[model samples]
Target: MSRFEEELKRDKFVCSECSRCKKIVWPPSNYCNKCLNETTWREISRKGKLVEYSYNKGECFGIVEFESQIRIVGTVKGSERPDVGQIMNLEKCDYDGDEIFIFSSTVQRNGSQNS
Candidate 1:
């Protein structure tokens, strides 16, 4: 399995960063997409901003942007309605043939309610 998938199986969110250019490589690669330099794996922050969301069959799903760049789609978990630009916290992550990410609403750093 790829390193990314392996880490996901362990519930650790990680991505590649360019060793030379200090750039975060999305889609996690061994080499940087920009400079083609070697990449190092690094854990990602759990908090992110909700970019968009939708409900399918009463289940909430959203696209969250992390570190201002890494965007991922995941299931939104919580009873409260989620809003765009709300802070989201990664609640769970796993891999079972397919990647799985679960997130929930969170308060902003300024102590403001997000959801």
Candidate 2:
């Protein structure tokens, strides 16, 4: 299959479609935080804009705004540029856990340059 198709077929197993807001939780609901009328196992657009980022000591953390949803913490791809506030695509990374996301190669928009 093509690379794009392969990406679409990638299994995002950890994502539980627990519709707590809908009062129908897949993993069982104790509290509904998102408060959406309904929640479904939908694939994220894979595209996002870097909203905030920080690097302390030797660790790095970034927040990406994916569509209408709030920002999510993400790991930058080793192959891609690690600049803060740069828009990128979410690609599966080879790291611990079920799946990891990385920034795409090309930057769609530029943020404030850091020293």
* Runs in model 2 lying further than 4 Å from the true structure: 1-36, 57-59, 78-85, 93-99, 108-115
Consecutive 10-residue window with the lowest summed lDDT within model 2: 22-31
- lDDT (0 to 1) per candidate: 0.92, 0.50
Count of residue pairs whose backbone atoms collide, per candidate: 0, 0
lDDT of 2 by residue, 1-115 (tens): 3232344356332222336544333332233445644445444556677776666555555777765354666665553336655665666543343334555534434664332
Instruction: Look at candidate 2 and give me any clashing residue pairs.
Output: none
Best by TM-score: 1
Q: What is the Å distance of residue 19 in model 1 from its true position?
A: 0.9
Candidate whose lDDT is highest: 1
Residues 18-82 of candidate 1: C-alpha lDDT, one tens digit per residue: 99998889999988999999999999999999999999999999999999988999999987789
| Model 1 spans with C-alpha error above 4 angstroms | 108-115
**TM-score of predicted structure 1:** 0.90
